[model samples]
Target: MVAWLGSYGTSYFGEKAYPKPGAVIMQYTGLSEVTKHEPPTYECVGTRDGIASYHSVRSYIRKIKKNGTDAEIQIFDGLTHGFGLGEGTVAEGWINEAVRFWERQVK
Candidate 1:
């Protein structure tokens, strides 16, 4: 499993994004083409990741479900975005969830 922030258009949000119009357009356009996935996906993202907005994850999950997959998202309220799994972190909760989901899917 891998976790990463959608940093593709972050440059538009960076300084020198004059007029705001260009930045807005780029942001919307980027979101329009988010990735797609098949069913049986177990996805987790933090609400406070500050990287990809909640909307991005929500959109992806919806697309997965529309494709008939079992997609799950566990959004940690106080955690920053992209706090991915590690050996000795609270992210263990998410890892455990994924393992459980994988077991069920494989069964």
Candidate 2:
């Protein structure tokens, strides 16, 4: 599985050099044309994110789901970008959710 944040996440999904991951957990990232790299992808973004628009993440999720892949997304209201593990934000517990999503792929 691949767990990435910010531009790193976009690069992992967009670039072909990296080996294809079994699943992806993307956090606060913009959309990359990743139709070719469809995997069980889990995405999270804050609605108030300025760096990476929440709409981009939603669009990416829609595209992946359209390709018949298992895609899950969580949009946290009133939160911004780069809050790793959501810390004290309303998005707390997102890591646990991502872990569960990854575990489902293994099964």
Candidate 3:
């Protein structure tokens, strides 16, 4: 739905990434065969990440859960999509939160 930044391309690290919902729908092509025996899933996404909205991730989590799997969703606040890229950027805190969440989940 980020067609607003078509000039910069869909991969732009700026405030716009996903040009349309098709970008998201296309990603689900691989999930069409998950059947019903998959393990629990953990999904972490940033609210401000235009590449993939936290809402979309939540929807996927719901689907996975409906199929009888545990799905954990973690949404970071005030962080951009690139929070996992740079060390000294604003995304560092989000990354730390994700790491902590992962550690807890793994244990």
Candidate 4:
């Protein structure tokens, strides 16, 4: 299992230096490319995020699902980039959701 955010999340898909993780918890990354053997993925991003496009992230999840790899996403309203833990925001509790997704994937 791996939990990554932003550029690290993007690299999780691209990096070939290490063995692939069984599941990935990705956040706020617009970089969307589905590898041949992508692990199950969980993602979250805010609609108001300036850095990562919400649509791009959705498309990425769709692509992953299309390829038969499990994927899920949480889109928060009126939130911006890097809203860490989303404390006091609509995105609060997103980590719990991501963890649940990770658990399902690993099981």
lDDT of each: 0.49, 0.78, 0.49, 0.79
Deviating ranges (above 4 Å) for candidate 2: 1-19
RMSD of each: 11.6, 4.7, 12.0, 4.5
Best by TM-score: 4
What's each prediction's clash count?
Answer: 3, 0, 1, 0
Tens-place lDDT per residue, model 1, 48-103, is: 66766656866766775676656666655556654657335445567777777777
RMSD of 4: 4.5
Candidate number with greatest lDDT:
4
Off by over 4 Å in 4: 1-17
Q: Write the per-residue lDDT of candidate 4 for residues 39-63, one digit (tens) a residue.
A: 7888899999888899998998898
Worst 10 residues of 1 by lDDT: 21-30
Candidate 3: lDDT of 91? Answer: 38
Worst 10 residues of 2 by lDDT: 1-10
- lDDT score for residue 30 of model 1: 12
Model 3 misplacement above 4 A: 1-37, 85-107
TM-score per candidate, chains pooled? 0.57, 0.79, 0.48, 0.82
Write out the backbone clash pairs for model 3: 1-20
Q: What is residue 72's positional error in candidate 3, in angstroms? A: 0.2
What is the TM-score (0 to 1) of candidate 2?
Answer: 0.79
